[model samples]
Target: MMGSERSRMLYERAHGLMPGGVSSPVRASEPFPLFIKGGKGATLFDVDGNRYSDYCLAYGPLILGHAHPRVVEALRKQAGEGTLYGAPTELEVEMASLISSLYPSMPMMRFVSSGTEATMHALRLARGFTGRSKIIKIEGAFHGAHDSVLVKAGSGAATHGTPDSLGVPEEVARNTLLAPYNDLDAVERLMREQGGQIAALIVEPVLGNIGPVLPREGYLQGLRELTSRHDLLLIFDEVITGFRLAMGGAQEYYGVRPDITVLGKIAGGGLPIGIFGASEEIMSWVSPLGKVYQAGTFNGNPMSMTAGLETLRELREKGHEGLFHNGERMRKGLQNVLDDLGLGYKVQGIGPMYQLFLGREEVWDRAGAMRSDATLFKRLYQGLLHEGVYIPPSQFETCFLSTAHSQADIDRALGSYEKVLRGLRP
Candidate 1:
C-alpha cells in the first residue's frame, strides 16, 4: 500500500476487464501485482522507489537483467534504421546465423513472436515432415497456450487426451498423446503401442514449468533412442532453458540434440522473439520451400533482433563462465542454508534456473514435483517478498537468475532464505 500506487491503480482498473488483473496468471501476486517503475542490473524499483533484488528475472527473458547497456544501445541504434520491414532483412539473417552456429542441431531456423508461436509452428512442421497426425507430449510440461498441445492425459494410460482447456475440441486433443516426464518406460510403452501414428515427441528436456526437475541421468539419451527407433521427431521445448543454461541451451547442456528446438524468453533480450530450428532436412518442410505454413507480422522485428543479437554477442564474448559460476554459488549457498536449518526440502533446477521444492525427496516428474509441500513454498514466497528478495509466486514455477545478479544480491537472498526457513519451523 505504501509503495504500490501505480500498480494498485492499474490493477483496480484491470479487474473490470482482465480475468485476474494481470496479463498472465503467474504475474498475479498476493494482495496485487507489484508495479515496477524501473530496473537496473538485478534490482527493480517500484513506483514508490522501493528496491527489490529480482529473482523472477522477468520470467527468464532478462538473462542479462533489466536495461542492459548493450541491449539498450543496440535497440536504440536499430530504431533509427526502422522497426519492421514487412520483409526479410540482414539483421534477421545474422540472428539466424548466430543461432545456427551455436545450435548445431539447427541448420535452419524460423523466427516467431512468442514461444507459443514457435511451438505451434514446430508441431505443424513436424506433422508435415513425418506425415503423422498424433504427437506425444509429457504431462504438465507447458509448450504454450496453444490448443493442440493443451491436451491432458486421460483417466488411464490407454485413453486419449481430453480437452485440458475450454473451447478446444476433443478432436484436436485426440491427436495428442500424453506421457509423464522422466518415465522412460512409460514413453517407450507409448511409442511401442502408438509409434505408427505419432508425429513427434515434444519435451522440455529440463522440465522447468512444473517446478525445476533435471533430466535423470541418461533420460535424454533414452528419449533420443526411443524417438529414433520409432522414427518420431523429437522436439525440445527449450524456451526457458535456451541461452539461460548455456550458448546452445539444453541441447548443448545435455549433449542430446533434439530434431527441432523451440526457443523463446531469452532470445529477445527482454523484447519479443521466439525461434524453432532443426536440420535443413527437417526444416525444409516449412514454407517458402514446402507446404507447412506459418508467418507473423512482427516475426523478425528489427528492434528485437538488434537487442537479441547484442545479447548473444555478450554471452559469446563472456562464454557464460560468470553466469554459471554465479548459479553454482547460489545453489551451494542455498543448500548450506537448508542443511543448517535441517529443513525437509530440496532445491532443484539446471544452471541459471532453479526452484526451492519443500519436498523431502528429489523431484523426478510432475507428480513428484506436485507432491512437494506447496504450503511451505507459499510461506517461503511471501516471506522472501516481504524481505525485498522476490522469487516466483508459485511453487510450480522456477526462479531465474541472470549474469546481472552479483555476490551482494545472492548473499542477500541467502540471508532471507535462512530467516524464512526459521519462520516456517514449528
Candidate 2:
C-alpha cells in the first residue's frame, strides 16, 4: 500500500482553511486526496514519493500528457515575455483562428478563464440572442458550477450526492429544463411544450459527467432538427470532449454542428481557460459589438493562449488516429481483463476517454449510471490507488488517456485491475 502519511497531514491541515479540505470538491477522496508533487508524461508523483500511472490526466486536459515539451517551452517563452496583458494579443487571435478553423460552426469565439465561465456566458448569450428566459439541458450533464446550469448536475456534484447545489435561486432552477441524455423523445416533448420560451438546448455530445454515456443513434441529428425547427440555439458543451475526441471535437467526431459551442479542458493545454463560440451574427451580440455584456481580466491571457496554441498545433501534427488507436487498445485490454475475470461490469467510452461502470447493463443516461454500485466502485478505487494506478476518485467521472500513455502503461493498468478484481471476488 502506498503510504499517505504526508497527504493525510496536508489534508488535516487544509480542513480548517478550505471547504472540504480541497479547493475542488472532486479532489477530496475517502482516505484523503493525494497531494501531487509533480507530473511527467502519463505519470504523477505524490507527496508520499509514490509514483502513479495517471488515468485522470487532470480530468481530461493533458491530452498531450503532463508537461509536454512543446507546451512547457511555449509557457516558458510566454512567461519570460509576459503572462497577461488584460488586453488582446496576437496569440489570442491565433488561438481563436485555430479553433474556428477546427470548428467552422464557431466563426467567432471569446476566451474566458474556466469552463464554468464559458458555459455561463454562452447561456447569457443564448438568452440575449433569443430574447427568451428558459433553457433545456441534459440531466446529469454538467456544464459548469453556475446557478443557471446547476440543476441536476453530475460529476463531482453527483459523486457528492448533491446534484443541485444550495444558494441557486428557485426561480433560476425553474427556468432550466431537464431531459434525459440520449433520449430524443424527452427532448422533443420538452421542446414542444415550451419551445417558445426556451432560448437554447445545451447538451454534451457524450455525457462525460455521469461517465461516458454516448448519444443514441440519430439523437444528435434529431436535436439539430428540433432546435432548427423551433428557431432555438443549440449549445454543445464540449469542455471535456473538445480536442480530446478530435481536433474539431464532438462536432467533428459526430458530424453534428451546434449553434454555440462551449470549449475548455484540453483546449487550454492543461492551463485554465474556457471558450464559447458561435456564428458571426450570433457572437456580434457580445459586448464591444452589441448589448450582451461579458468581459474577463484573463480572457486572453498570453500564457494560456501560448499553451493552447502549441497544444492544438501538436494535436493537429500528430493526428487523432493515433489517439483513437490508443483508446481502442486500452478498451480492448480492459474488456479482455473483465472477460478473463468473469466480471459483469462493463467499460464504456469513445476516443481517449472511458469509464468502468459496475453494471452489466448499458449506461446510456443518468438513470443507468445511477444503477452502478457506488460502494463497489469505492472499493475498486481504493484498490487501484493501492496498485499505483490513479483514475478519477469518483465513479461518476470519466478517465482520460494522453499521447504519452503507451501500450506498456495499459498493460500495467490491466494487470493492476486484474489483481484488484481477483482480490474483490467472492
Q: What is the C-alpha lDDT of each candidate?
A: 0.87, 0.89
Compute the lDDT for candidate 1. Answer: 0.87
Residue range 1-426, candidate 2, lDDT tens digits: 569999999999999999989999988889789888999999999999999999999888899888999999889988999787787799988999899999999989999999999999999999999999989888889998998888874543321223288888877887888887888887788788889999999999999998898888989999999999988999999999898878889999889999999999888998999999999999999999999999989997998888899999999999888778888888788888889988988899998988889887989899899989877888899999999999998889999888899988988998999899888853
TM-score of 2: 0.97
Q: Stretches of candidate 2 above 4 Å error?
A: 153-163
Query: What is candidate 1's lDDT per residue for 255-285, written digit by digit as tens?
Result: 9999999999889898888899999998888
How many Å off is the CA of 270 in candidate 1?
Answer: 0.8
Q: Which residues of candidate 1, in runs, are more than 4 Å off?
A: 1-6
